[model samples]
Target chain A: MTIRQLSVFLENKTGYLNEMLAQLAKYNINIIALTVADTSEYGIVRMIVSDPEKALDILREGQFTVRMHDILSLEMDAAPGSLSKILNLFTEADICIEYVYAFSFGSKSIVVFRTNNRDKAIEIINENKLKSIREADLK
Target chain B: MPREKMRALQTERLKELVNRVYNNVSFYRQRMDEAGVKPSDIKTLEDISKLPFTHKQDLRDNYPFGLFAVPMKDIVRVHGSSGTTGKPTTVGYTKNDIDNWSEVVARSFTMAGISSDDIMQVSYGYGLFTGGLGAHYGAEKVGCSVIPISGGNTRRQLQLMADFGSTALACTPSYALHLADAMAEHGYSLSDMKLKAGVFGAEPWTENMRKELERKWGIKAFDIYGLSEIMGPGVSHDCEYHCGLHVHEDHFFPEIVDPETKEPLPDGQEGELVFTTLTKEGIPLLRYNTRDLSTLYREKCECGRTLVRMKKITGRSDDMLIIRGVNLFPSQIEHVLLELGETSAHYMLYVDRKNNLDTLELKVELDESKLTDTIRDLQNLSRKIEHALNSAIGLSVKVTLVEPKTIARSEGKAKRVIDNRNK
Candidate 1:
């Protein structure tokens, strides 16, 4: 299961996002999951696509100013204490997490996170026996 | 003196320069050795063909004191580029070199019909760049009262021009236009000002631009040409006739050569203009390539200066864009933009390679009052701009309508193009 993610550098304008989406439509690349991380000068439009390679090539070819990143995916129970329990495990292991976002794919609750020490976090995840999904598994 | 006597004198100076550089600077000696030419071999001015040509990159590669023929203690002043992107090209001057530069600038001012009683307002920026200080020293040498305005503060510029009764102005042509716009906004009539003439340079401008400035400000606009590498903005100046800019070839030798072939071109044939500073002491250059595209004229001027004259620079070799085997220049776009009355001069050109196709997108700012929020108006403007740019540049451009004041305004050199073709 491959999760295609887009990291776009977007300068602020009235219809900049609309233009980007229109270009994507022209390439027939579908966005599965999308979020915008923004500052004053520009915004990064991150998206998981149905076809990662095709989307990346299309965006790069069009000079739309985009990047691709591999993010770890963890499925949590859709219960009250699920997120807290998973985060507490990382804190116990002294893994520094930078940012995290959550989204739903069908009935499953998936959490994507970035960490300061990726290798160490991976070791911690293996030690605690937490179920970690690779980008391909997310597909 | 006869032309034959002048040629002999130049040859003698050339031999002296070659011998001095060969004996003093190791770089020149090594380049001479690599070229298999010796200083003793240079017997005539035409023997310059045997010597190697120096380039701007040579100065940059050597950096601070690599090319200086004199000791650091003997050097009096140092000027340089802003070094915004890379290491600045540093130029050193002895006291005598400073005197020579001032004298040449004074001659330029005199050629423009500025008198000793004239008051000059120098608006070119000072510091690292030589334009402001060069003009200031030149004006002083010309026995004129000089105001070193030193760029920006348009309101204060207008105030001083009126208060000090500035008779002549020296600055980049674009800033002169900007000042004209400022005066209009303040409801000040340009005719009421005491200004009589303007000396504009440090960038290439067109005849249409000169005519526009002359009509708007009621002043005779003169073109002055120079580079920091060759003693700043006093190398040459236009006379009242405006036929060509006269070069002070006694100190600086001018040549035009085919950029691709490196072969010398005849007079009136357009090519890259090259200069060799014959009199510079600190950092004398032999056959320094200026990269500016222009032609040379040896004809006598009505002003009585017998020095060689250079045609107004049409474009630069490096600035030429080879897109789809068609050469284009930003000035070509400028010609079209000037014709479009509804569009502001401020614009941004985006060039990118998509699907192996070169795409040109022009973002032009439209004056809001002149534009109606209608599709037909936008379409018409776009089509007109497209047609004009295509006709002028011989390349199709996609015109994008942007709001007023959308593009950035630069106080120094404007950033006109954003090239994304490389990725």
Candidate 2:
């Protein structure tokens, strides 16, 4: 299972985020979940949008430098220790998570991650019988 | 000499200078020949306008000593400055050339009221740069007991200023302020030192710097203008009037001309400053376009020197910054930032190459009062800055917003450009 996440390069400027959002908004795109990674000079905004391909097109057409990255997205029980328990498998496999973001909906929580070794992470995910989502499941 | 007589003297000197260069320096000879002119043609001062303009590139092309108008044995001393790339610009001075240099600088010191009784400490860096020894010989000629205190070692400078009872200072204006700072930390004030007047040169300084140095040291601050190519420091010096630099036009003739058209501009019309060395024996230059933008005033000063005075140089045509193939001056960017408000004049241009393409990153500070709790506001401010810079420079640049006082402060010539591409 894979999730197409969009990464956009952004200058650390005021209203830049709003401008990015506004550009997506014009095309009626919905941002499912997003997080920004930043240094002093510039920042990169990563997003899991309803339509990743459409969002990429809209942002790129607006002159925003965008990159499409396939990340591992999983569904977990909305319970305490759920993330830690799932993460222990990766710890055992010695796979490192580059970055991660999560959102909870009712009793189900969705976690998206970029890792150093996707194959190892995926193998661990399959061995644990972890329920992952493909691009169509988001719709 | 009177102004009219000075013009005649300059005309005669110009003719002699042209002939010397045509006969000795092959570079100038070729340029002169290409212009379809000979040494005999430069009969008057006006004939200088007909000569081909010399650029910094020409100097770089010639490299070490291709422009020397005298034999190598006649050259007693050599001075050079590093170019941006490749070879450095070298200047030669014969024994007579050194003497004349000393004479002009001595005249400059006397004009600044420094006498043999005063302990003149020269603090400009010695070595290849003309700042140090230029003031040294001049002050020594003026009978001032020169301290020969070359640049750096701040504490020692202050200590020597106190220990030696140095009565006059010669260095860049910024170093003077730095010394003022050093003195404050030593539990001493301006009155403790015997510094009466400071002859600041070797770099461009503003009138505000003069006022600040004057106020801090309780001494008069005078501007000295000279370039290594034109016989080092003492080409001109501002008298007590502080109006403009009174150029030693007799030895090295001065001209202001349109940089684009290369046509000589009338006095008071600001343009590129050009020079022709009349008395330089080792490396006589013919119409060396300094590219320093300034205006010339022919009126005699109240101090009674008949030498023409050039207005303080504002900027350089060659200091033209080209980032991402777009041409702009740093002052233009500064103007845009100041106009936007919520920022200090402080900013650093960090130019680098990303993906083999040139990228400019402007690191600027946000005004202290404008610091906001919302990240959105800061982002918006940066966007506004990026937009304005793009509009002004006609090229998009990455704007990095830094906190107040984030950018390092400079005491001397502010280090504005940090080119990271080379490394």
Candidate 3:
């Protein structure tokens, strides 16, 4: 139903993002999904991983402005219309979508979105009986 | 200057100055009559507020001799400001006015504890700027061997200080820093010169700068307040205590007034400084608004001067930035940023009107090491900067962390404010 997304502050520079990924790789922390929010000067990396708490501590030790934000994670049908069907519920409710990123989970696809009203979006997911992912389910 | 007598003499002189301006200068006369303020309305020093407020534009409208209260034959010397904007605001000094000017400057020098035995160097610009001449006359009156080396010619400025054993220096605070640095480059140490005291003015300077000069030369740094319109360079001088500058109230009556309302603010309140030339004979102003923002202290300083003292000028009303109804100065932001010590002193304020709302953006350079390969590091650092600046200025400012050397460095009087909103 929900997973904590770690948002990392990074300057928009080459080899810097690779350096961070190398750090995560050294810790053997597997990633679930990652997306970047960028401006001309800097960029923000939002990631969902196998272990968020451990990743947060590791990044905090690395001296980063790391914080956790609850994001709606759903395992929808792999069919094409299935994606639009889940998004249509949020569109009807006028819930603003900040950004959405997805990754595959075997036969099912894992999709998460950042929205203005996450609780309401979650409510819509439950009322419609859409399959939702949980934190433990990621492990 | 006793306390009771100071008030009595001010009351007496205020009445005379009001009449002189109202009768002799048409600009003052019309403005006074329009405000329904008569010369008789002023009976006390506090009653001086009833008179009309004068602005720089008022002088511009009148141009040259329009504001002079005395006749041309009586005007012995004319010193005009370099009109950077429009016509240069011209000020006249009669034979009596020059004497009074020199007398007040001499008193200011004495207040700064400068003695006749001290060798004084007047480095302030001599020509149109009154700093060099005003300081020269006062130091001369004090019987000190005056070094009339005007501004510029830094090599010679340093050469003279070393050769003549210049004991006191009078120049802009920034120029003083340049001279101090130049002395080192010229292979002259502080031991080589005999600079005992410095009276820095013609620009606003901070306590931090004073401490720097004090450490650099091992001398006392004093703030001297003045403007060309009222009197030159010696309008007020700080005593040994350095609590505040003791205004030469007998000659120039100082008043603090709200810049917008033109109403006199009570003592201890910070506002635009207004002055009435108490004994200025050539061109007496009723209440000339200086636009320099500072506070006045009525309490007697530890130096025991009965004259009113004023805080150092921090920012001018014209330099104030009104962002979303919050009043702020770029100096305040620079202060907090420098105090944090993580960033360089270089910064640029970009103010723009976005979406019909005022937006303030402070772009500060981040030391490369502060940002590791971590993503959240810069974001958190920027948030911390935003919080500090918000607390300092009480306005939520958008903070942008740029790479070092991105912001331009200034050689003289750093350009801090960039108002893109007007464009």
Candidate 1: segments with Cα more than 4 A from true spot: A1-139, B320-423
> What do the candidate models score in CA lDDT, each in turn?
0.79, 0.81, 0.81
How many residue pairs clash in all the candidates, one count each? Answer: 1, 6, 8
What candidate 2 keeps of the native contacts, as a fraction, is 0.03
Q: Model 3 segments beyond 4 Å from truth?
A: A1-139, B320-423
Error of 2 at A134 (Å): 3.9
Ranking by DockQ: 2, 3, 1
Model 1 lDDT tens row, B1-423: 355766777888889999999988899999999999999999987778778888777887889889988999979989985321135678999888899999989989998889899999999888877889999999999999999989879888998898889999998887787788789766677765899999988767779889988987899999988887888888988999898998878788888989998788889899999887888898888888888899999877786767788999887777555454233556667767887776887788898865334689998876544433123445677788899777666568998766555588999978888877545
> TM-score-based ranking, best first?
2, 1, 3
Q: Interface RMSD for each candidate model? A: 15.4, 12.7, 7.4
- Which lDDT tens digits does candidate 2 get at residues A38-88? 767766688888888788778767866667878889998878898999888
**Residue A74: error of model 3 in Å?**
63
Q: Could you tell me which 10 consecutive residues in candidate 2 chain B have the lowest summed lDDT? A: B319-328
Per-residue lDDT for B413 in model 1?
Answer: 77
DockQ, candidate 1, comes to: 0.03
- What fraction of the true interface does each of the listed models get right, in terms of native contacts kept? 0.00, 0.03, 0.09
Candidate 2 has which clashing residue pairs, if any?
A: A13-B379, A14-B379, A14-B380, A15-B379, A15-B380, B116-B143
